[model samples]
Target: MGGPAPPAGPGTAGLRAVRGKSIAVLGGGSLGLYLAGRLALAGHRVTVALRPGTPAPSGIVAEGDEQWSAAVEYADIGRLRGPYAQVIVAVKSHDLPPLLPALAALGDGATEYVFLQNGIPWWWRGIAGDGLPRARQVVGVVVQHSAERTAPGRIRVRRTAGDRYLCGRPDGSVDAALESLAADWRHAGIPAETTPALRRQVWTKLMGNATLNPLSAITGATVGELATEPATRAVLLAGMAEIARLAERDGAGVDNTPEQRVARSAEVGGVRTSMLQDRLAGRPLETEALLAAPIAIAEEYGEAVPVLRTLYGCLAFSSTSPERNPT
Candidate 1:
């Protein structure tokens, strides 16, 4: 959406997001903590919602010296109210039932939404099926370099590339407001940008997630372990090919080659896939979003995703009995 506009200046985005832009984060997971901490650190009035029956967050400050004790309040997403200028969704895909109605309750005709989730956006096509109010729905890709969840409310983000994110409309509505907000995200220690295209960005990241995340989870192996093993490397390459074909079908151009795609993952070292951590903790894997969705897409295109299909099926069964998986 490159349009004619004045070049970005110091005060251009300064007035947009810095003042009175209240943000509500949905889930109380590590992602919710990370975003809330940064936003709170940036002086935005922020609130993080925790689901019922979940323990209250214990710490006053995040793992880093980032202090969010004062501005960051805890609320329930399903019953949140307006006065919030924007809503940042950092919940698991399956955990939306409680929040949809609450967000609808806000009744603010112009509340911006930023969805922070992994894997494909195919589910959104279904959620937005009936033309759900399209006022402002921005897609984002976050390259979070740090990962640590020591306890329920405790998290450690060792490094962040500023706001290290990208945001824009999926249907090509490029304007100054979104760009200004993106700039604010950058200033909040979370490098961000506004892009005209989101479909490509989503899948490009999914290439590493679909392969690295699951394999690492199953093997209890780090990215380095998975990338180096001959058999694991072969599996990762095959998965990448399928993801590339799927992206092409959906009109997202990305390097789908095994060698190139594998490198993207090999760089992550011994990081534990979120799913692996969930399995170890006896929490439900985000199986439907991360694994099932891609397999469904492969079937839609009559494409064979043998490795992915098998991996998904195995994980599917294992979800019923978390301890059943040998790893």
Candidate 2:
């Protein structure tokens, strides 16, 4: 209901104080590599924990309009022993399970866990339903940027448009650590802020993802392509309406109309959706988190999500078809 809190201290100098603190970044994906490079460049001691057998690169290289390179320490997930200032989980939602037990092994009360995945994360539901351990400090991060890994330990960040990041607790509580992390990210030129209403932010982003992602995967179309076509646009709006209803039922206030969301997507132009990329790459689609989870929530409330259900069925089938080969 309110805006983000102001930064606690002066500009880049205050953010620089975050340096020297140890951070363990889980997952060697695009976003993860980019964050590791940025934090390392900000002078923090960053260690990236990749899956076993992943080639250990000498350092991470970030490229786009401007280039940034930072030397980062590397470790296998099984080898991580952290009493770190923060442990950022940036893996795809579907790839999260195997890493969970390893993360829990880091000790219950030792480190702050920051999850940067898209859609509804598992921890979010735990916080809302069963509640996480009191000792663990969990922060939810919503990243709004276009980034892709060009190679091992190399990433290209295409856009840092707008307030590109949001971090907060699931229970709508203010957190000083989250605010400081946001400030550090901001100092690194990634627009970021700490909000009390993180779930609202999650729902807002989820509204667009629920509709566009699966539709793009099914049709192999770009966001602009889907937005400009009348039939696809209709399906998009219908799916968004269903999700908006579900959001209201779940107690998150999302105040944008379907048309407004479509307009916003149109402005993003030809960028391919992540689901489409995963589908083409023959990787496991994030159907559960982006589609199935929302559908389950809708069913729990006895709400109809005909469009969403149809999309989910199509994606689920495609994800399992023998014709598709894993890359």
What is the lDDT of every predicted structure here? 0.66, 0.76
Best prediction by TM-score: 2
lDDT of 1 by residue, 1-327 (tens): 322222212122332344646787776777677767666666787777777656566543555433233247776554567746667777767775445545644535566776777876533463453324343555454443545576766775544222246676666466776776675666665556666766676777777778887776677787777887899999988888888888898777664476876775566556677777777777777777777898888898898888788788777776787557545
Candidate 1, run of 10 with poorest lDDT: 3-12
lDDT of 2 by residue, 67-153 (tens): 767799999888888677778889899887766655655635646788887887787665432223232378788776667777789
Cα miss at 15, model 1 (Å)?
15
Model 1 residue 21 lDDT score: 66
Q: Estimate each model's TM-score.
A: 0.84, 0.88
The Cα error of candidate 1 at residue 197, in Å, is: 1.7
